[model samples]
Target: MPTSSVVVVSKCSVYPDLKSTVKSLKLSVSDLPMLSCQYIQKGVLLPHPPLSSADLLSLLKLSLSKTLSHFPALAGRLHTDSAGHVHILCNDAGVDFFHAKAPHLSTEALLPPPDRDIPPPFRRFFQFDNTLSFAGHVKPLMAVQVTELGDGVFVGCTVNHAVVDGTSFWNFFNTYAEVAKGVKKISRSPNFCRDTVFNSPAVLVLPEGGPSATFSGDEPLRERILHFSREAIMKLKARANNPTRNPDFCAPEILGKQSNDSWGLNCKINGKITEENGLRKDPTAVISSFQSLSAQLWRSVTRARNLNAGKTTTFRMAVNCRHRLDPRLEPLYFGNAIQSIPTIATAGDLLSKDLSWSADLLHRNVVAHDDATVRRGVKDWESNPRLFPLGNFDGAMITMGSSPRFPMYDNDFGWGRPLAVRSGRANKFDGKISAFPGPEGNGSVDLEVVLAPETMAELENDLEIMQYVS
Candidate 1:
């Protein structure tokens, strides 16, 4: 299939001016870390457009403009203050929209056999290959690309990471779908206020131009969009909740037994949470689909790498902090309110522990990051703010991003439910995994896993991980 070329790139402005209403929105500590990240590029693949390319684009452009009215930051510019802090100048400048056509390409190209890697054309589906989130200072804060396929349309959107996180990004996407499908009223109005209930601003001066959001494109990686069926997920969840001790499950030798005094394992138990010596001991202690799946992935990846027992491995998760606060941020609060929590354990411990044991570790660590924890992170950053470390720093780190909770398949621009979800090569590195929900509302999940060539080969052959990989 020949790659698609962006035939046209135009500016799509918001419908009404909002400068008077929102003069300038301040950047929060959470938003600052993303300055080092590239634009968040993700979109859906809808089959068979009912209208022609021109006709469909006109409707989409109009709907997108109206949608931008609700999300001014998407159309605004990033402004830096004298103190070196960043802010959004809500001037309604507009976002970049690109139109493309792949005359020889077919939708089938993107939907390859489950055994093969994602087709290369999916990389050409978006326009922002090198644009960083901080580049919003001079470039459009957002960009959308619509590609006409033989049997489908690829609606790829790239939003400034410094402006919105995954939650707010989907909010704007779904709102556009609503308006495009003829919904007059905005379903979820965005709240762009950066003032939080546990607020503390981290104003750090920049070095040179700003943090470079570059990822070496030269690295060879295997990006697999693995879909886990509801049944497969249930199997993992069952294993995570079961107390049947397997001969292979080994207790940690050096770390000894796990401790339970902090916050009483505020973790999300499958049914009811009961604590025993800092851990859940119930044979029926249920675990969630995400917890089960993530823990399994964490363990399987570690095993595949075949690292030394004493080497430390880390799991970094982007946690939402809105409702976790004491007072709680009001609903629909926009901007980045996420804290990337890094959970650490020795490779030996993760590999030796039972599935439930590792899941419990992930659960308790997340639960422990409550209001005070979030506040302390902010103040610590204020003392010395730094850009996000975007790679596998310790050669044993796995970073989990995007959530199955995000409404990825809800991007039905009146065409129909999406056939699948896809993304571009922006800020991608080895050991980075992104989770998306299955098309049906069942318990199934999809993981977009990126890893080195050798690791991916070993992981694909790992039967334990493959047994539940539907």
Candidate 2:
């Protein structure tokens, strides 16, 4: 297929005055020290429109303006203080708005098959220009691109990650949609009080962390989409629940005999095993679909890379701390409220361990991020601000974000729900994975995996992995 070219129809700044209800906002401690670099892009394709391009543009502009009036921080620009702390300058400088068109493309053409790679044209839907650089004094913290396609309209938003995480990003979009749809009251109003996160005056600095230098190579990274159906997920659950054929061989020494007893006991306690003839009953686990899928991908990706068995591999899982913290944050609390829970394991042990073992490990790590841990993390970062050390991907370090719980497919601007939602190419970093709810809304998962070309090739054909993909 020929790549559809996007032409910019209009470019302008959208300055929306903050409503009287909104006060001057600042970046919270959790938001500081983040790379003023990355932008989170979300692309939504709305089918055959009820409104013309001009009408849609006007509606979007008016709605976005009103929405920003409530979310005044988005209309602001990033500024650094004398102590190097980043803050939002709620000056209503404005967000960048681009009106674009892809005359030849259709929503259908852009929605690639499950086994195929997302086309480059699909990514062009997002407007990512000066919105990405926070070093400038007048840079936009958010950018919106509205593209007219043959069959539908594509709305792409790029929000600076330094100011917003996945939750805040979607919250902004959903609110925009609500306004466009003429909803009188938004379901979740944003809470912009930065003081709620921290009261310390010290400038927060992110811990220094990047891809491992030792494993850095020149190989190009590739992105692929992997689909796991509801049925497939069920089978994976079953497989994970089933007792290993060779427990003595597969179980690590750290688990020992107690590991076998625990596995059997869990199944028995959960009624996953029948009293008669020892036939396996319904699968159940303390771990959830997220843990199971994450564990499976981590193990399969490690094997696909053919990494040294003795090498250390880490899985950095992003955990939402909104509810995990004491005096839980409101559902619409804005800014970055995510903490990474890292689980480290030797490649040999990780590869050799049973799926349940890995899932249990992930589950435990996730459960560990309670109120105390989150508070401690905040204090630690406050005392010595530093970015999370994410050493080189080199196939050993993996980072997973986004969540099936996100309402990516639910943002409707009166033209019906989005036919497909996608992430921008900027997320295509090696060993990075994003999880989205399946198109069917049937409790399945669609994973967007980015890996080196060779590793991806191997992953595509791996029998063990393919067994659960369909």
Candidate 3:
């Protein structure tokens, strides 16, 4: 509840467009009223030192109550009428607080102790024991726990996926630090209105003669989440980055190896066998792999399976479109400033696609993104007389560069920089992948993959193979 930490870094300059970016996000989703910030709250547990349990709880409740008053967004309440539409409750809901108790079991060597039970608060919120359901009511997105360690308290926090992305979440946490430190006054600000950006979508229609493209499906496919372990990830990253000890090895070298060594590609297809109905070379795709995966994906990729014979599968990469958009909107406009570019080949294709081919295709695609015509093409497609194809793609792999220079880590609230920070959930689509910087500031990144069970196993096997090679 009390924000206090040593300082690591600081940025006094405010991004001029910061407020506009937030305003744009609220506007873009005006149609989805249920997705408001009033319901978006973060849970953090902080350990107390030299304090009694009762005394600690009381102090926390008071601090949290005061902290909520300052956020304005959290202080406000929401209500759903009989119509099922959400309305802002004009009054304060007053932050709620309750004491957490550890379960008890008598020590007995003869019999195994009863299964360790989860605390009530954790159960109601995390439901860590249950399977995740996308359609179910989204529970509390995050919760922070304060545990009393020997010398100090540890603060743990969790957040929901729908309310904020990583950038916005940190922004909120920074604001919290500002509030707890008495640096800023909390006002009953009504900043969550959605009309600011989308308020004028009609004026931003696309231009005619949009770009040509094809779609795997008419709709943007649903996303999936996955998680991978730290050790296994490190091994894959090391191999991907520098497969050969030879100093000359670079992207080209790695790319070539990936294509030529893929399982199906390594095995040649007989020319005569191609004449058979099901013997044609597989048309699968292998896309770019990133440096790391988000925490939520650790489990999914760890359990993925390999692809079935002859089935086509491709990996995808999300390219940031911030700079590629209208130059007039440049200087770094935020809010979904990205689009998915897919590179696919079957599992065999991934192994067989020559690195030069993969690299060339990547180079071409990357260059195409730089041209202004791409935006024009997008506009043309939007305004076309009939539906336009976006692209044919199966899944995605997202790469995020570490911004240690960004104020994200230095967002000090009278406290020191965070030891760890990450997204609450992985991407929402199957074939989704994520990554972030690893410790030690090495060029390597942590990675995660979300694939079907069979595909996941295949990836693991491939990873083992890479380990053996290096």
Candidate 4:
């Protein structure tokens, strides 16, 4: 079979020329941690529209300019002051936009079935590799690539991670989509006030050369998409909260497939299982839908890797601190306002526990992050600034970065709603998994799993794990 090919047609800088007096936006405490992290490289795939390729491209570019008028910081570049503080110089620096073509690629090829690997041709729509976030000092803070495929189109955006997180990134994307459809008023504009995140001014000192992006961009891995239906999630949630003797639950740990102990003993006490006794239930720890799924994935991946029983396994997830704080933040707060929370357990213990045990473990940790926790975290970072440790260096860590709650399918750029969402090859490691909401908005989820070929093979063959995967 002939592989798909992408030919870059043109690259240009797009300026908003807002003619405003806003000069700069300082990097917040939430943003500084991402200096070493790779850019956010994600976009959507759409069906072929009625407009000719030329007209569609022109409309996209023009609307991008109009959209940037609301997000001036995106058209700016990063800067470092004498005291080592970083800022986004809102100088209308312009965004890097690219035009590309993949004449032989089709939607079917770009989106293979869940069992197959995602083709590399889809990644060609992205311009950045594992470029560090600090590179925004010289490069465009945001880069957009529009590729023309055989039957449809792909619009991929690469935004500096230090500037916008998943929430702010999608805000801009949805805004751009509305602008493309001729919406004059932006429904949600980014709020640039720093006080929303901190009571006092926040300054971040850079490491001597800043954080290093250690990815080689050539790791041999399988990019597998795991789709779980809404019904599957509801079933998982019910299994975790309520008592059940069903043998169909996913998660090797919960099924007692990885251990010698009986699953019933680990899950139940004295022939009765309730929220009280099933999970050593923390009265305040209410297991969430996503936490159950994450716990299951953690267990599945651990079993797939076939790690030693004594090995330590850790799971980290990005938590949105917007509504968790006391006063709460502005809904449209720009820049980063998220934090990573980690939960650790021994492989032996995690696998020995029941489904609700791990699910409640995640829940307790998430619920413990309150007002004081956020304040204390900021204080600690102020004393010692560091870049986000994104990669899974030891192969025993699972990092879930994105959320399945983001309104991704709602973006319609005049043509139609997106058929699917895809990401680039930036900051992807062996155990890194990005979760996206299903394109149908039906409470389903799609997890883009990146792992070694051997582990992926093991995970694929793990029959119990494959039960929940559609």
lDDT score, candidate 3: 0.32
Q: Per-residue lDDT tens digits of candidate 3, residues 274-367?
A: 1123232432221222312221122122223333434454434445444454443332222223344544444444344433344344435654
Once fitted onto the true fold, the runs of candidate 4 whose alpha carbons sit more than 4 angstroms away are 1-4, 198-209, 214-218, 243-285
Task: List model 4 lDDT by residue over 1-470, tens digit each.
Answer: 14348889999988894753578888888898898888999999988878998898899999999988899999999998887778899999899999998878888888777778877876777987768999999999999999988899999999999999999999999998999989878888888887665533556656576668755556788898999876576567656655454534433454332111111123332343324334435334346668878888888899899989999999999988887888888878888999889999888888888778888788889889998898888888877766777777777899998888777876899879998999998888899899998776556788999998999999998865588888
> What TM-scores do the predictions have?
0.89, 0.86, 0.47, 0.90
Query: Per-residue lDDT for 458 in model 1?
Result: 89
lDDT of each: 0.77, 0.72, 0.32, 0.81
What 10-residue stretch in candidate 2 is worst by lDDT? 257-266
| RMSD of each predicted structure | 6.6, 7.2, 14.5, 6.3
lDDT of 1 by residue, 1-470 (tens): 54444244444444433343677888888888888888988988888888987799898888888787788778889999887778899888888888777656676777887778877788877767877778889988888888887788889899998888888889988898888899978788988766674245557567788777545656789999888866566557557766563322322331133221121222334344355546556523445557778888988888888899999999889988887888888657899888988888899999888888888888778778899999889888888887777778666989999888787888788979888898899878888999888666454678999998888998998887788886
Candidate order by decreasing TM-score: 4, 1, 2, 3
Pairs that collide in candidate 4 are none
Off by over 4 Å in 2: 1-4, 17-23, 129-133, 197-199, 204-219, 241-269, 272-285, 388-393
Give the residue spans of candidate 1 off by over 4 A.
2-20, 197-201, 245-286
Q: Residues 312-426, candidate 2, lDDT per residue (tens digit)?
A: 9888898888988779887788888888888988899998988887777787888778999988888887788654443345458888988877888878998799887787765
Candidate 2, residue 247: the lDDT equals 23
Number of backbone clashes in candidate 1: 2
| Backbone clashes (count) for model 3 | 69
Deviation (Å) of 296 in candidate 1: 0.7
